[model samples]
Each structure stands twice: as structure tokens, then as C-alpha cells.
Target: MKIGLYFGSFNPIHIGHLVIANHLVEHSDLDQIWFVVTPHNPFKKKSSLLDNYQRLEMVYRATKDYPKLQPSDIEFNLPQPNYTINTLVYLQEKHPDYKFSLIMGEDNLKSFHKWKNYELILENHHIYVYPRLSKGHVETQFDNHKKIHHIDAPIMELSSTFIRSAIKAGKNIQPMLPQHVWEYLDEMNFYK
Candidate 1:
């Protein structure tokens, strides 16, 4: 099986995420997409993040109906400030028969060289880049690389930060999130 590891903070999984995942499964060679929820992204601020379990649950609720999509807490068991290279290596060892690819946005690809052992990741795994609005057109050194593929998936300007801010401001965010996720957030009084 070819699995695409779509890593994110998923402070609250939203529609943009769903759209991207669905698009990848339908249009790419990926057999499945695992939403690898990062417990602590080195690039992000830990103080602004919700609990790992909460974020994982919201992802689960949002993607439960899609068999091709799964919510994974793989990084939670790994070290703090999880690095992509380590996770990929561990996954390869545990699931030797399954091939894994990295799925990310073009904005992330623009700064991917700064990631730990990024060159090793590029050499070993396939990378699928999806477009994100307002990031501007970024041309990478590896644009012509065979292992790296740029996909024309639908772009959404929506972000978890925007959703959280809307909720905190007492604004309606039902349209931004999955129905079940919105209900879960309301029931738990999250992000308010």
C-alpha cells in the first residue's frame, strides 16, 4: 500500500483539510492518506496548540466517513518537537511492505529545505505538493525532480488560525469546519 502522510497541527481540522485529502485520494497515486497529527511541530509554537488528544479526536471526527482518509497520532508516541525524518524512518521499519509519501502545501515546500534532514526525505520518499492561496508562485530547485510532484488540487485560503480566531471572537465558524467537528467544539467549549 502506498500511504501519503499528511502531517499537520490540526488545532481543529477544517474543510480545507478535508478538501485536500479528498483531492489527493481521488487524483493522486496514493492508496491512503493518514493525517499525521504532530504533537509538537518544531516550526510552530506549542503554547498556541490544543492538546494532542483533542486535535486527534477532531481529525477523527472530521474524516471518519472517508475510508481513504485516517487520523493518526503517530507523532505523539515519538519524541517531542517531532521531526519528519525520524517519523518516516520509524514508519518504514514498522511497516516494511507499505510505501510512504509526504503530502504538503506549496507554502511548506517553499521552506522545506530548512527542515531537519530534508534532503534525506526527498531522496527516500515521494513528495506531493498542493497549492495554497496567497502564497504566491514558488519555484523550487527541485521543480523538475521526478520524485516531487506538484498537484493541481483545489486551493482554499482557510486556515486553523482563522477558524480559532473566529471562534474566540464569538463568530460563526460552522461553515469552516465539518459539522461533527463544529458540534464537538461547541460541546467541549473549545477555542472560546
Candidate 2:
């Protein structure tokens, strides 16, 4: 099966995430999208992230209805400062039968060069980059890569950082997150 790996911290899953996953499955030839919940993204700030299990559960709640969108806890067992190249290597070794591709935003594509073994990832796997704020920049730079694809994914300004701040200020996050995810966060007093 062809799997598109949508790796993120998922500090709390939201509608924007579901929209992109749906777009990828519906528009692309990918069989499914696995939400690889990262324990600690090398480029992101660790201070704001919730526990890996909690983040994974939120992703589960958000994507429960979509069979094509499944949550994966693969990185939870790996070492800290989760690197995409290592994770990809591990996944390839374990699931040799399945073809793995990357589903990342255009913003990330701009900084892809800084990632460890970036060339290996580009050579071995397909990268589906959804358009983001930095559209022109990302597209221009990615023109050199044959394995890269550009897709039209809605650019919602909503972010996990914004949601976390809202929750900390006792604001409602219903507009940003799925109802099931909101309920889960409420029950656990998450982001508080």
C-alpha cells in the first residue's frame, strides 16, 4: 500500500489537519495518510508541546471517522528530538512492503535542506507539498526535485500555538478543533 506520512507534533489536532489529509487522500493516489505524531520535532520549540501519548490521542479523536486518516505512534518509541530521516529509515526497514511518501506544507519545504540526510529523503521518497503562505519561495526552490509535487490545500491560519494560547486564556477552541477533540481536551484539562 502507498502511505503518505503526515508527521507533526499534533499538540492538539484541529480541523485544518483533517482538511489537508482529506485533500491528499481524495486528490492524490495515496492509499492512506498516517499521522506520525512526533515526540519532539527538531525544529520546533519543546516548551509548548504536550505529551506524545496525549497528542496521539487527540489525533485519534480528530481522525476517528476517516478510515484513510489514521494516527501512528511510531516515533513515541524512538529517541528524543525526532528526526524525519531516521524515522523514515526505521519505517522503511519495518514496512518494506509499503511505499512511504511525505506530506508536508510548503513552508517546511523551504527549510527542507537543513534536515538530516535531506538528499536521501528526496531521492527515496515522494514529497507532496501543500501550498502555504510562502508559496512562490517554496515552489521556486523545489523545482530542482523530480519527486516533489504541489497540491492545493486550504491555508487555514489556525495553528496549535494559537489553540494552546486560547486554552491557556480560558477561550473556546471549538472553531479550531473537532468536537470530539475539544471534548477530550476538556475532560483532561489539556493545555491548562
> Please, what are the lDDT tens digits per residue for candidate 2 over residues 105-167?
877887888889998999899999887765356345667678998887787667888899999
Q: How far is candidate 2 from the true structure (C-alpha RMSD, Å)?
A: 2.3
Off by over 4 Å in 2: 41-47, 135-140
Report how far residue 104 has shifted in candidate 1, in Å.
0.9
Q: State the TM-score for model 2.
A: 0.91
- Candidate with maximal TM-score: 1
lDDT of 1 by residue, 28-118 (tens): 9999999999885556666768888999999999999999999998888897766899999999999999999999998888888899999
